[model samples]
Target: MQFIEFKKEHFIHDEKTGNYSLEIPKDEIGFGDVRLQKKQDDGSLAKIDAEIIDDLKQIKIILESPQDIRVNF
Candidate 1:
């Protein structure tokens, strides 16, 4: 199966803050905050902390997972 990947231009990283920012236009994802969850070892999802910037235009995520992530993204 194939999955949709985020556009290259949408991914941004702030070197100073060690934060990964994803640029989502209001038209694509709406003008609201997006909830992100990380899959746990037990096959459950846990809410991960993230920061929203410029409304829905940007979302900052710090991936600190000790193991490899298997996100559906």
Candidate 2:
């Protein structure tokens, strides 16, 4: 399997049915804690905690003051 960093175009869900959908931002990388958006009935999004998939690699967050958050792939 190939490693893919989470992108804005990626959709995350706890279940395969996708009853709940979360949109990730392109500039953001999976790290310590992340807030996700849930697709709603009105076609709007709501804030929810994102669930990390077991198959995906856990990204490490490196804190470097005044720099963008680094994620190890």
Candidate 3:
């Protein structure tokens, strides 16, 4: 298991909406072991929603939880 930092080339950033979309390789997910978290001011992680792409070998994550949050997975 590896923690990969998201890069610009990793996904599509919509200039109009100012949203980021990321795709994770399905192989990297062991038994669908994936999570979404939003960092809090108290240094805590809050779980968020993540969309899974069943047709493709990847998972799609949209960064739209909280503006002051540093979202991670």
**Alpha carbon lDDT of each predicted model:** 0.46, 0.33, 0.53
lDDT of 1 by residue, 10-72 (tens): 446677866555554555545444555545669666765555455535433444322212223
Tens-digit per-residue lDDT, 1-73, candidate 2:
1123333333333354534333333344434444334445575555434333422444322111111111222
TM-scores for all candidates: the values are 0.47, 0.26, 0.52
lDDT of 3 by residue, 1-73 (tens): 4344444455567678777777666666544455555555686667656454543576667664222232233
lDDT of 3 at 3: 44
Q: After superposing candidate 2, which stretches have Cα over 4 Å from the reference?
A: 1-33, 50-56, 59-73
> Candidate 1 has which clashing residue pairs, if any?
none
Q: Where is the poorest 10-residue window by lDDT in model 1?
A: 64-73
Clashing pairs in 2: none
Pick by TM-score: 2 or 3, better one? 3
